[model samples]
Target: MFRVLHRAGQSHDLTYVVVVIGVVVVHVVLVLVLVIVVVVVAVIGGVEVVLVLVIVVVVVVVVVVVVVVAAEAASAPVPIVLTTVTFLFGERTWR
Candidate 1:
């Protein structure tokens, strides 16, 4: 309805235009916010997966290093001895 304003009355079409623009802007902002939230969640989930994988790798590496070092220590021919040492905070020396 494209009705023109009379000389004594204001145009009703102005209010319709403002209402339509407001509705459109609100819908656009809501959709943009939804997209941003989804993207953020996906990024956080991806980071969590990477962190879990890194932890698993570190654990496996530590296990392998310990096994190798133990094997080497067992195979060594030299005898190891413990000596007593004193610390600054304690009067007792290590036995």
Candidate 2:
């Protein structure tokens, strides 16, 4: 992905680079959330009752976070992108 972005930047397609980066950030967040949920379930060892409760809570939290982020990003996406990037990359882009 970084390679693609570098190529795009060299070609001067800033719009395409921005779009790809946005899509990647969204996907990375979704995938990370999914992996975490899967790991949590596996560690719980399929306890039927607890599993169902955990799934419900996880779903609700995911939905809420998505909505809130979407709302904020709609107004100014740069901060949102920086936040997600900082989250995934341990490097702060936004102060």
Candidate 3:
């Protein structure tokens, strides 16, 4: 009976080197992907913050203007009273 004999003296250094290189490449790729994701998230967050600030500023300005206009209107005398007085007294006498 003839039996095939396998050699057990093979050095696994090449295999180890290949595996190490592959691991390094994969790690580099993952790190690059993570950096890109972080940068994108930061940029989006910055834009959102700026947009919110702008909206807040606009709202504040609109409210201030509305309040000022309302105060002015409330403090002033009635237009109808002035008009009636002017009509009764005549323009020259009132002036």
Candidate 4:
């Protein structure tokens, strides 16, 4: 009976160790997965920021071009009679 009890106690200790090892493994895997997910999210956010910056730069360039073109057109001279005739008809008819 004594020997049997000793054997049972030994087995119980081994079971506890196995359970602790399993828990530790699960915890480590979870931490690794979390790290990967965070890295992916950061990379995606960085790419999004870059894309937005590119779009903003393009819009600014287009706005500048439009402003410059409008200023040039405003500064150009037009004969009053020619302007009136063209407005009544069209540039295609004048050509």
* Tens digits of lDDT, candidate 2, 1-95: 56556766898977657766775776778678767776787777666745775678678867976886787678753445554565456453444
Residue pairs whose backbone atoms clash in candidate 3? none
Q: State each model's CA lDDT, in order.
A: 0.43, 0.66, 0.46, 0.50
Q: What's the TM-score of each model vs. the native? A: 0.36, 0.40, 0.34, 0.35
lDDT of 4 at 41: 58
Estimate the TM-score for candidate 1: 0.36
Estimate, for each residue in 1-95, the C-alpha lDDT of model 3 and write its tens digit. 00100111144334333433443454467567555655675577776765665566557656864675466447644232233333345445556
User: Highest lDDT, which number?
Assistant: 2
After the best TM-score superposition of candidate 1, give how far the Cα of residue 25 lies from its true spot, in angstroms. Answer: 0.4
| Candidate 3 lDDT | 0.46
Off by over 4 Å in 2: 1-46, 76-78, 91-95
Tens digits of lDDT, candidate 4, 14-55: 543433344345446756755565567557777676566556
Alpha-carbon error at 58 in model 2, in Å? 1.4
